[model samples]
Target: MNRRTFIESMGILGAASLLPISCLHMQPTTNYKLGYQLFSIRDEMTKDPIGTLKLLKKLGYQDFEIYGFDAEKGMYYGYTAADFKMILDDLGLTVSSGHYGFSGFLNAPEDILIRFVDQCIQGADTLNSAYITWPWIAPEQRTLDNFKIMSKKLNIIGEQVKAAGLGFAYHNHGYEFDDHNGQNGYDIILSETDAALVKLQMDMYWVMHSSKYTPKELIQKQPGRYVMWHIKDMDTKTRDYTELGNGSIDYTTLLPDPIASGLEYYYIEQGGNFAQNSIQSATDSATYFKEHLQKYL
Candidate 1:
């Protein structure tokens, strides 16, 4: 049977029967590390990547997920990948993942797509990131055909990333859940791609905003597919970005089954509408994680 068919037949049964009871209760074997996405402080990163890293370190963030890798410049936020790696090392921070746009893969010629993937692999290797993620799909390119094309390219790129000793992932936005002839873009991508090659980095706010599936339900439906999570909360009223504890998602319920969810790393990401200063917002999220979320970890 195909991957999607097999997944459907198993349903929640597979996840329920296969997952160890201890996964729901056992503490993480290693140190529980909390991370932040540098996009949360894009302005600071643009002005001074080093200063941003230092401040994030001071806020008790040990890991990060970065964005804006310029393939042509061979840099992220204007620093060469190697230089950025050095800065991270000096601050005792690790970049577990980074976001890269896939426009070249979607629109460029085959040779250009190959070059883009090569650049991504090189940058990811330099930063020692575990996953290099495709983070967005433009509104105009949300068709099923586009998703199919993306799936094929993602599988190809994922293989190259795997060969380079890293992983490839897709980061979700609410658009993926939009209905398309009864099969959403997300369903197409998940079903069409090789699971071993393409992992998922689920954003909590987007998942909630989609109103289709909850984080826990998605985990149960597609066990071991999601490897990373963007932990942003939705305001109860506006359903927009809010600091961790101040929002609507009861992470307390969703975070306990990391093994079942295939969650290896999670980064707190607050996108705009910060309750206070962005740095302070990040600190508050970190504080909540340390005080409340660590128990699950």
Candidate 2:
């Protein structure tokens, strides 16, 4: 069955009874707490890291996942990890995790792995996060052999990270699902990697966009491997992202087995939102989750 039908036809044990209360409750409740990806506030942060963080605190966010940090300036935009962490802590927010790219994974000299691990350790220390995530792969490096190479490297990285009292995970963009010689890269990674070391941070919107499979099916297929998610909704008609709950991704239904999808932390992201103000966009998404996702609890 197609995704829409697959999700629709599948019965939730308490869906009907749950819906009315979830949809009708006007008091503003929270089922699942939410997080913001620092990248979403890149512009404002680039201009003012401390200021932007203060704004986020004002927005009522309690957790964060960073994507970039400018060491020289001591910030994600210009503050150091410690400085940023202080802001988050002052607001009673935690920095759950952050995304690093593939460069560290494919280091030049083999011994560089030690230095790489140290760098990740330092970053994790500053933020007090237990995870350092690899969030992307070079588009051209999409191949079975490349994936296998990455899997091996990631296993090593994961081991190193674990030793440092932190965890390691790979985040997906849509490209990972593209068929490479009849095999999906994500499937390859899952099948071949060390479960104890490497984990998956599935980006639900991208996974849905890629047409590889349904989010629920993948979660069911590999329970507990997904430890986090990048949550956003898709405009079914436009085949693009929309604010959460304002679009068609039925998060309510998905919540019954959220942990099954390996979800421990969920961050809100929108790759594009041309019309709305960026902060407003994120605010709307968070508000939707606070309202609609409450039923899942």
Candidate 3:
């Protein structure tokens, strides 16, 4: 989905309960949540969330990062939070996090932001999601000034999320790396936000595609602040998102220390440019991830 449709909607479990495998002295991979961003197969999800989830489970996915939240209705896809949780529970699946429509309220009043955040909390509480993520900022709101302003809002939302025993995170896109003199929007977000309150969700594709910093370099900027990741590959020729391993990113060697990243959960995502179709792309990526990357993660 594009930014508008993504925003048109929009934490949970605490950090302590989600100790990273790397931090656990190379504990079994089963102890960690291997997830996929539903946006990668959004069409199938919209058509049949249950069946699509079942397919993902069969493909070895155990956790999910949800999207297309209807905040006004407190619904995901078309089911209420309670109903959706029941479905996941029945399937032996879990939601590690959610991508909510937070950018829409970037400039709204405190009351408005609070009201919306409370609504988000309700759904996340029901689903037991680990983090509620602010995925994107509209193009017009990407200015350096807005980046500073957005960081303040992140702290505000992060406070509420923490208060409710949930975590709050921000997911980055390529645009965040856009340079203004020597600094960029990401520099402001990393510096201005309260690390205790707010966390970072690194989209590796974006870091590889644009940022002057590599994934490891970015993680070094804030050791334990990065709690989640969106792993995808870029088309070698066009540099667009593609099925994992079908493109140029060699995650086998590219991954940083999960312990240092303070990582808990990660989602495999493909925004578009699927090799054949969305579900096929998801299946293919899952296969590659399980065979080549899940061990590293």
**Which predicted model would earn the best TM-score?**
3
Reference-based TM-score, model 1: 0.89
Superior candidate under lDDT, 2 versus 3: 3
Choose 1 or 2, whichever is better by lDDT. Answer: 1
- Report the Cα lDDT for candidate 2: 0.74
**RMSD (CA, angstroms), candidate 1:** 7.0
CA error at residue 164 for candidate 1, angstroms: 1.3
Which residue pairs come into collision in candidate 3? none
Candidate 1 clash figure, as a count: 0
Runs in model 3 lying further than 4 Å from the true structure:
1-30
lDDT of each candidate versus the true structure? 0.85, 0.74, 0.89
Point out where model 1 deviates above 4 Å: 1-23
Query: What would the per-residue lDDT of candidate 3 be over residues 118-231, giving only the tens digit for each residue?
Result: 999999999999899999989889899999999999999999999999999999998989999987999899889999999999999999999888888888879998899999
lDDT of 3 at 292: 79
lDDT of 2 at 47: 82
- Estimated TM-score for each candidate: 0.89, 0.83, 0.90
Candidate 3, residue 132: Cα displacement in angstroms equals 0.5
Residue 16 displacement in candidate 3 (angstroms): 27
